[model samples]
Target: MPRLPYLSGVAAATAVVALLAAAPPPSGEVTVSRPRVVAHFDFAQGQTPENIALEPDGSADLTFSAARQIAHVTKQGHTRIRATLPAEANPRTPVVGDDIVLGIARAHDGTLYVTYATGTRKTGVWRVAPGGAPRQIAQLPSNGLPNAIGLDERRGVLYVADSVLGTVWSVPQQGGTPTEWAKDTALDPVPGSEGGFGVGANGLKVHDGAVWVSNSDRGTLLRIPVRRNGSAGPIETRATGLGGIDDFAFTGRGDTVLAAMFLDNELALVRPDGTHTVVLTQEDGLSNPTSVAVRHRTVYVTSGAFFTMRDPNLLLADLGERHDR
Candidate 1:
């Protein structure tokens, strides 16, 4: 939920240099047209869209982080709240942050799953079936900040990213107790984080038979293969040096992906071999983008504006004729 790390100049430069291999060649090396604004938001009203779940009907269901609400954005650029989560009088969520909704995933049956971080016991995974009310399906560790949630339909389970705990948890598709699916130093926050929440494993995805994660604090992307017996396979650091990376979506072009770099206010196309290209920037209406979702030839990005405190909007970029999936 936090953006803009206040790292020292030298350390920041080093981090950027280290990620050069995963970055676009140069500013002019890639030419991405400015994305068109799909819908503007009122940050003061807490309508900052944090995560997205695209539906088959060409609409998107989103989690409004600070608003404690789920909304729907239509193809015509219209939007409305689909579900409103419980508001707290006092939020105790870790890292001195307010109670908020972060990552979200949609099921085939129109069910929506979301990750909520409240300092209280209500902190966990919640599900809403179309028009039904939000129900707690799984109770995760309240000590950590659960940021992203991914549902593996093939495995019939859910994978959660705990940014603070540096762990990935798995819960039954039917909703139950969560078990530790994977944990390692690669998922932990860096040592000298003096700004933001010092988050790790911020974004998550279950694709190509693997659980992919982004470590915001460490600036690394990881992939953990799912074993046949439902166990976590060896961990692989696929990409690195992407500081402030929040959430990403695979372009369906094998391992290619689009990542939202929160601190840099940019979006990057991370290739299969670890190199990347900056496809969009603040000039394209990105203001601390938090998450991305790709559907066919369109790229959907959510600008949370947590740092700028300005326009929190959604931008849509067309990848020309290149199909996403």
Candidate 2:
């Protein structure tokens, strides 16, 4: 028998909650049948919200470089100042490009991991305690430039996508040497184009014993089975032709995945069978989206005016019952 994709429904609610907290609530208040725009925030005007991470409690957290701060946005739209990166962490590291926290991951114990790259000169991982300061975990090897970070809730492994070498490394969440778990070539079939090799792995996640990566250059999503010991199995392609694909998130539904296509200016809803359709397109409110997160049926996205810039926007998308479709 073929592998079955996970589907979201009332029956899966428990699993969804156990897997991912509410993280962020739907931007819209009223419930609808299909996905719709709920709330919008523009960073270009100084509201700088960079990478977003959702908690199981329906709350959202955003990293802001302008104020050198991290904020927690509640389900009710209330924003709180969580903590500020000390000048010493030097979030403004010359090489880190003003955007150190390009990716964020939270473990089941509530430990938060942030990835930073500073101008090919220096780059390291930071682990944020529940109520303590962010401490350096491990420095990226000279050949590695951390672009994306993902957590394996089951094995206590942290997955980092290196843009410099287009490879993925599995590091112990507790901190230690990392191993090459998988590569982007899994999705790229053409010679010199395996999963757009050499283009850098931009986004990644390990779900249900499988690893998924965003090959932004090739506009494809790559998946491969992951071993508990941090080894990787054969690779496979999940979805493709996603113009300017930036990031992806599961809708708590097994077979469903939502992808953010920056260039296309739309959110592509994908099924496990490799079929997808645009469920939400850029309307009057969204502009240059770069990341996505889902809570319940609500989808939260971060938009920016330019890539690798301090300017960004926070746009909420309501998936409602359409998630069932």
Candidate 3:
């Protein structure tokens, strides 16, 4: 498992108190209401789900970051191992104890793309076919730490975010050398931030003729224009101060987004106007949400519980009627 410096008893208590104080009041009307839990993981499964992908049948394909495996959770709540990383694929590096699988994207043809890293020197993006071994698609730079992946199916390109390098890379769908697609100051860590976990550009998604990405340390969301010639155009900021934004998904509405705030231990509903509201929080059983996936009116969130007091869980919420408010 990825380890971090431990805090003393007093320091830990102080951190908890500080977090509680920073949280918004439990009772307050917001544009999007809190969602209810639809499923959770039991103690038997020692998996820390990091990213989520939806199957055609409504099942969820999750990346087990710590477990070094991929798991499938059916709509009926049954869990099964879809694939496991080989030991060689997750060798230990200087920065982390072992390579942890982070980003995951499913193609229309049922292929799964996963990104993993132990340290800058050993990071890679892989393509996994059903019932087949993982194939290394692209090897990132020595100082690049790939975090999230998004596929542009129409153009046969895969976009990946490099957290440490603060850049987005575009690779051929069939696997080859990656080229820098875009890089900007907005993708860098926020000024005055303590720089916890060394994360910056963390999430990537393709939506509405553009590619969307989130800067975890900077707490910013950006959209990169995708040109018709399969190249990237200018980058634009969509939102800021989103409280440690992570992997997010569109709500199928006008610029509405469901974002996981890792540091805040909450889920935020962000609007196109750059305003946001806390829709779900730790009080609602979110330990440290890392990603959110939406399918129609149903929402699924994966809490890694990376540095929290609770265990990891896969939660579901229904946006059926509450989303309108």
Which predicted model would earn the best lDDT?
Answer: 1
Candidate 2 C-alpha lDDT tens digits along 180-248 = 767655432222323222334666766777878877656678887876555887777777666456668
**Global lDDT of model 1:** 0.83
Best-to-worst ranking by lDDT: 1, 3, 2
Preferred candidate (lDDT higher): 2 or 3: 3
Candidate 2 has an lDDT of 0.60
Model 2 worst lDDT window (10 residues): 1-10
Question: Candidate 3 lDDT, tens digit per residue, 161-230?
Answer: 8877878999899999899998887776544346445667888889999999998766789999898887
TM-score, model 2 to reference = 0.75
Residue pairs that clash (backbone atoms under 3 angstroms), model 3: none
TM-score for candidate 1: 0.90
Name the runs in model 1 displaced over 4 angstroms: 2-34, 192-197, 321-325
